[model samples]
Every structure is written in C-alpha cells, then in structure tokens.
Target: MSNFWKRAISGFLFVIILTGCIFLHPICFFVLFFIINIVGLYEFSKMARRMEIYINLPIYLFCGSLLFTAGFLDAYIGYRDGYLWCFLATFVMSIWELYRKKVNSFQNLAFSYYGLLYLSLPFTLLIYLPYMTSDEWRPEIVFFPFLLVWFNDTFAYLFGSRFGKHKLFPRISPKKSWEGAIGGGICTIGAALFIAPYLEGLTVYNNIIIACIVVFFGIYGDLLESMFKRNIEIKDSGSIMPGHGGVLDRFDAVLFVIPAIFVYLEFVY
Candidate 1:
C-alpha cells in the first residue's frame, strides 16, 4: 500500500478507537490511557537505551503505573492523597540507584523519573480533566482539546504543503513552516468557535483562548519530539501504529497540549 493510504487507514482507526474509548465510559477512558502510558514509557526507555542510557524499565513502569492509578482514583473517587505515592516511589528510585553498581546509575535514575514526568504525569492530568468541567464526568471537555489539536495539525499540513514560504524550525522539523503554523492556529480557533456552544462552562472567548493555547504548545510538543528523534538518529518513535510511528509519535502533541489545557482550566475554573 502507498504511504498515503497507510496513513489514512491507520489514522482513521486510531481516531475511531480513541473516540469510542474516551466517550464510552470513565473506566474505559482510564483503561485506554493507562495502556498508552505504559506503551509510551516503554518507547521512551527504548530511545534512552539507544543512546546508551540504560533505564530500569520494570521499575519505571511500576512507578508510573502507581502514579497513573493514583491519578485515576483521584479523578473518579475524589481521593487526592494517592499522589503521595508518586513521591514515595521517587524516593525508592533514589535508594535503588545506591545499591546498583552501574556507571550510569544517576543517568538511569534521572531518565526513569523523567519518563514518569514526561509520559505518565500528562496522562494523569488528562484523566483528571473530565471531572473538573462538571460535577459528573463529561467527555466533551476531554474531547474538545483533542479536536483543537487535530484541526490544527490537519490545517497546518494542508496550508504548509500549499503555501509554505518560511521554515518554522528547520533544525528540528524541517517540513514545518511558519505559514502552516499560523494557518493551523486560525483553523483551530475557528473550530473552537464552532464547538464552543456544545462545551458547557466555556464561552466562545474562552474556547478561543484554549484553542490558541493548544496550537502554540502543540507545535512545541511536535518539535520537542522531533528533537528527541533527531538526537537519537531515528525516524518515528516506533512502528506500532504503521504510518504513524509509535505511541509517542502519535501522542507527542497531546502530551504537551493536555497539561497546558489542564493548567488553563485550573486557573480559570
């Protein structure tokens, strides 16, 4: 199959599965992201390993799972204290490094924690977002940010391909252009305006602001992941998604945008 067809088919299936899981029920939402969290952590560990930074994958996964569960329970059952366990886990990692006689023990320990913060924390925040918008769970709150990111990415690709004049960041992501980024921001803002009424508690103005946030940070997220790939001398994070690369490749923008959106909502609402 052509790369275009492969991309289209995989992207379609991904959207369908993700949308279904997100909107079906809160448990499904948690389960889906919990799995993503683990996969993303594994992918990061592989990347670090390629650079000779051997991370303890099992310990990272266990700690990350604890953090994810803490965030999940906090969101669903109103138990905020579970986050304390993440701190305990961090201390345990430090102690474990003391016993290991590896030369890069500190590097391993640091990246393990970094993986947790980079991949796990954002997902934890995502699980908590739906609960913040309403007294009960509201998937639309979770869904809208994704919609903005999708529109931004789609329009950016289209516009950049058509009228791209200047590079956005040639060093990291050569294909991205300033024209495309602006076009994406405008298109995302339009989507926000159109969907504002459906999202309770967010006025059109607020939705526009949120879309702007998503666009700005989403681009950075893409660039950040690109930098990682460039440093590692690899294309795509992994091949799990066929044309889309890996979990990190698929969720690079999401990892950045979700946290920004969560912070925005926390301050505003």
Candidate 2:
C-alpha cells in the first residue's frame, strides 16, 4: 500500500477503536490503554537499550503495570490511597536494583523507573481526567482534549505547508514552522469554543485556555520524543503501525498534554 493510504487506514482505525473504547465503558478504556501502555513501555525500553543501558523488561513492565492498575482502581472505585501504592512500589524497585550486582545497575534502575514515570504515570493520570473534569463520569470530557489536539495538528500542517518560512526548531523538528504553530493554535482555540458548550464540564473560557495549553505542551511532547528518537538513531519509536510509527509516536503529545491539563483541571475543579 502507498504510504498515504497506509497512514489514512491505520489512523482511521485507531480513532475508531479509541473513540469506541472511551465511550463504550471504563473497563474497555482500561483494557485497551493497558495494552498500549505496555507496548509503549517496550518501545521506550528498546530505545534506552540502544544507549547501552541494561533494562529488565519484565520487572519494568510489572512496575509500570502496577502503577497503571492501581491508579485505575483508585479512579474507578473512588479510593484515595493510590499514591501510597506507587511510592511503595518505587521503594521496592530501588531496593531490588541494589542487589542485582550488574555493573552500573543504577542506570538500569533509573531507566526502569523512568519508564514507569514517563509512560505509566501519564496514562494513569489520563484515566483520572474524566473524574476530575466532570462532577460525574462523562466520556466527552475524556475525549475533549484529544479533539483539541487533532484540530491543532491538522490546521498546523495545512497552514505550515502553505505559508511556512521560518523554522520553529530546525535542530529538533525541521518541518515545523512558526506559521504552522500559530495557525494551529488559533484554530485550536476556535475548535475548543465550538465544542465547549457540548462538553458541559468546563466553560468556553476554560476550554480556550486548555486549547492553548494543548498546543504549547503538545509541541514540547512531540519534540522531546523526536530528540529521543534522534539520539537513538531511529525514525519511529516502533513499527506497530503501518504509517503512524508506534504507540509512543502516536501518544507522545498525549503523554505531556494530559498531565498539564490534569493540573489545570485540578486547580479549577
């Protein structure tokens, strides 16, 4: 298949599946993203390993899963002690690393914990977002930020391709342009306003601020992942998708955006 067709097909299916899961049921969201979380962890481990870091895949995945599941249960059940589980798990992992006897085992330990913090923590907080955004569970609240991101990305690409001149960051992402980022931000705010009423959680004003947050942090997330890939000497994080690269590539923006939005919603809620 042509690259464009491959991208279109896979992107369509991903959106469909993700939308279905988030709207279908919390369990569906949990199961689907759990898989994505694990795949993303593996891809991250692969990248870290490229730097000659020793990664204990099973232990790291287990730790990541521990954080994910515990947080999900807390959100799902209204329990408030999830952080205790996370902290205890971190301490245990650190203790185990001391006895592993590998040379420079601390690097391995750091990478494992980093995987948990970077990949696992964001997803855990993402599942918490709907609960934070609404008085009651609303799937639309869960999907709102995603819509903003899509708007920003789509318009940014269109505008950049047509009128791009100055590079936004030539070293990290050569294709991005200042014209695209601003155009995208403008469109994102408009899109947020358009959807704000339907959201029924945050006001239109709040949503606009969120639109701004998504654009700024989304670029940081994308660039950070690009730097990771460039340092590791690879194009995509993995090949799970025909054109979308990997789970990490697909979710790079999401990882960063969720936390920032979560913090904002926390203060406002």
Candidate 3:
C-alpha cells in the first residue's frame, strides 16, 4: 500500500477507537488518555536521553498517571495540587539527574521541566474540559477544542502546501507560512460558527470568541513544537505514527492551546 493509504487506514482506526472511548462513558475516555499519557511520557524521556539528559522514567510516568487522573477521573483535584505533584516529580527527577556525575547543567533541568510542561499540562485541559460543561452540553464543548485544532492543522497543511509564500517562522518551521495560518484560522472558525447552533445552552458569542482563541493559540502551539525540533536538530519528534511522526508531533497544537483554553473557560464560565 502507498504511504497515503497506510496513513489513512491508521488514522481511521485511531478515530474509531477515540469515538468509541469518548462515547462509551468518561471511564473509557479516561483510560485511553491515561495510556496516551504514559506512552507520551515514555517518548519524551527517551528523547531527553538522546540528549544525554537522564530523566527518572518512573517519576515522569507517575506524574503523567496522576495528571490523567486529575483530568479525567477527577479522582484528584485540578491544577493546584496536581501541578504541585508534577513539580515535586520534577524536583525528584532533577535530584536523580544530579547524582549521575556525567550529566550536570541548568539546561538539563530545564529540559526535564519542558518535557512535563509540553505533555502533561495541556493533557490536563483535555481530560478536564468535558466535565466543566453541564451534562447535557458536555460532549459539545469537550470535543470542540480538539476538533478545532485538528481542523486548523488539516486546513493549514493543505492551504500552505498549495498557496504558501510568506513564512510564519522560517527558523522554527520552514513549511509553515503566515498565509496558511490565517487561512486555516478562518476555515476552522467558520466551522465553529456553523456548529454553534447545535451546541444547546452555549452562548454563541462567547463560544465563537473561545473558538477563535483556541485557533490562535493552537497556531502558536504548532510553532512551539517546531521550535523544539529545530533546537534538537531533528526532523520529527518521534516515528510512532507512520506519516505523522510521534504523539508529540501530532499533539503539538494541543499542548499549546489546551491550557490556554482551560484558563479561558475557568475565568469566563
């Protein structure tokens, strides 16, 4: 099969699994996110190791598990204690790094925190979002953020490839262009507006604004991940996904937008 067909089949299977988990009850969704969190953290730690910075894998995994719990199960509290726990995990990992005589630098510590910041934080937004809405409206609000990001990414890649000229951040991501960013934002926001009426009990104006914010921040999210790859001098974050790269590559926008959206909903709602 061609790479395109292989990717299509894999993407289809992923969507089917996601749809099944999300609709099967919050528990299923939580489990799926939990597994994703662990796998994602593993990929991150492996990447760090490549740089000769050893992160305590057990600590990172534990923190990721707790983050998944806090977001989905709410078996733990939200940002306050969850964030503290993550910091503690970082601290412990730093201590471990310190003991490894061969690796010692402020940069390594920063890298450890960056891994958690990149993966765990935004994931919290995803797991928590659905529960924030009224039961009747949860599904509408919950999935829209992810859908918006995906739409923005899809449109951006397609439009950019066809009509791109001016670079958005040439050093970070050469393929991305300002034209694509603006075009993608417009298209995804249009979709949001089209679907707004179906989201019963949501304020249309507020939701539109929120949708725009998600798209805006999501663009930066993609760039930030690109920055990481640029700094690391790597083509992709990982090769987990055939055509897509790693979990991080696929979720770069989510990492950028999720926390921002969570904050927006917290203050606005």
Q: Highest TM-score among the candidates is held by which one? A: 1
Per-prediction TM-score = 0.97, 0.96, 0.88
Q: Which stretches of candidate 1 lie over 4 Å from their true place?
A: none
> C-alpha displacement of 143 in model 2, angstroms?
0.7
* TM-score of candidate 2 relative to the true fold: 0.96
lDDT of 3 by residue, 54-140 (tens): 766776678677766655544223345655666576677767766766554566667657776778777767766655554432655
How many backbone clashes does every candidate have? 0, 0, 0
The residue-by-residue lDDT of candidate 1 on 43-155, one tens digit each, is: 99999998888887677888999999998898789887778987888788788778777678878988898899899999988887767767788888888878888999999
lDDT of 2 by residue, 158-211 (tens): 999999999999999999999999999999999988888788768888898899
Reference-based lDDT, residue 221, model 1? 94
**Model 1: worst 10 consecutive residues (lDDT sum):** 127-136
Q: What C-alpha lDDT does candidate 3 achieve relative to the native structure?
A: 0.73
lDDT per model vs. reference: 0.89, 0.88, 0.73
Error of 2 at 219 (Å): 0.5
